[model samples]
Target: MTSALILENLCKSFGSGADAVQVLDHVALDLPQGQSLALTGDSGSGKSTLLHICAGLEPFDRGKVVLAGHDITQNDDAAGAALRRDTIGLVFQQFNLIPSLTVAANLAFQARLAGRHDPDFTTELARRLGIAQLMSRYPEQLSGGQQQRVAIGRCLAARPRLVLADEPTGNLDEATGDAVLDLMMELAAQAGTALLLVTHSTRLAQRCDSRVHLRAGKLQVPA
Candidate 1:
């Protein structure tokens, strides 16, 4: 199967010289299309940094990053933005929904930005996420779980080739988080989007097709 995301010899650090802190060291990974992979590590383990690099939201000191078959290691700001607009979906733990927009509008925002707005698909996603009736509600009016459902709906609305999620369910209780994750994985599979999820839950990580652990700024065998 073709890979949707690849990282080779990736290196990243903060600051410079003596005060510099290495975050990623020669990290390598290959995530095949239409599959899911869980990335697990302790706090400060660089898991979120890795996801950001993959999404072109951050830069690495040295390495190669390819998303949906396009090399992004040397991409300029505009190029990186274009790559994200065209091929990547991001879901954050904070449920980054636009407070000014109603749930329906928020759900279609990313798709509209990507020029892939599909009313039929958006409606179906809302129905499946159990947020169809909340379409007219604003982000601030929804509960944490509801807001997250909208966030997931918005990300997948763009039909992106790859989805990067950073602790998407961290705000919810265990049962709610599990349910949200189940919905996310199910929808991602239906869309055939490659998913790289950064999470701390062992049970959640085990639900994915494969798992990778990060330690000491390098990829380690999954524990």
Candidate 2:
């Protein structure tokens, strides 16, 4: 299977020289299309940093990052932005929905940005995510779970080759989080989009196709 994301000998740090703090060290990962991998680590372990680098939102000190066949390292700012818009989807714990837009518009936001907007597909996603009835509602008008379902629908509506989610279920109750994850994974599978998820929940991690724990900026099998 082709890989949607690839990282090789990745390294990142803050500051410089003796004052520098290494957040990621020789970190490497590969996520194939249509599969899911969970990333687990303690706070400040650089899991989110890794996801940002893969999305071309952040730069690595030394490494190669390829997203859906494009080597992002070689892309300039505008090129990287375009590549990210076209090939990557992002979901965050905060449910970054545009408050000004209704649920229907929010769901179609990313897709429209990528020029992949399909009215039929967007409507299908809204129905599948159980947010069809909430489309006319604004983000603030919906509950946490409802907003998150809209967020997920927005991410997948772009038909991105990969989805990089950082602690995507952190704000919801356990049951709600689980249900949200179930919908996320199901939707990802249906769209054939690879998923790389960051979470601290062992139960949630186990639900993915594979799990890797980040320790001291390196990945290892979960103990």
On lDDT, the candidate that comes out on top is 1
Considering only N, C-alpha and C atoms within 3 Å, which residue pairs clash in candidate 2?
A: none
Question: Candidate 1 — what's its lDDT?
Answer: 0.90
Global lDDT of each candidate = 0.90, 0.89
What number of clashing residue pairs does each candidate have, in the order they appear?
0, 0
Error of 1 at 110 (Å): 0.7
- Model 1: per-residue lDDT, tens digit, 1-223? 9999999999999999999999999999999998999999999888988988888878789989989889997688898899999899999776879889999999999999999999999999898778999999999999888898899889988999999999888877888788778878887798888999999989899999999999999888675
TM-score of each: 0.94, 0.93
Q: What lDDT is reached at residue 117 by model 1?
A: 100
Q: Who wins the TM-score comparison?
A: 1
For candidate 1, what is the TM-score?
A: 0.94
Work out how many backbone clashes candidate 2 has.
0
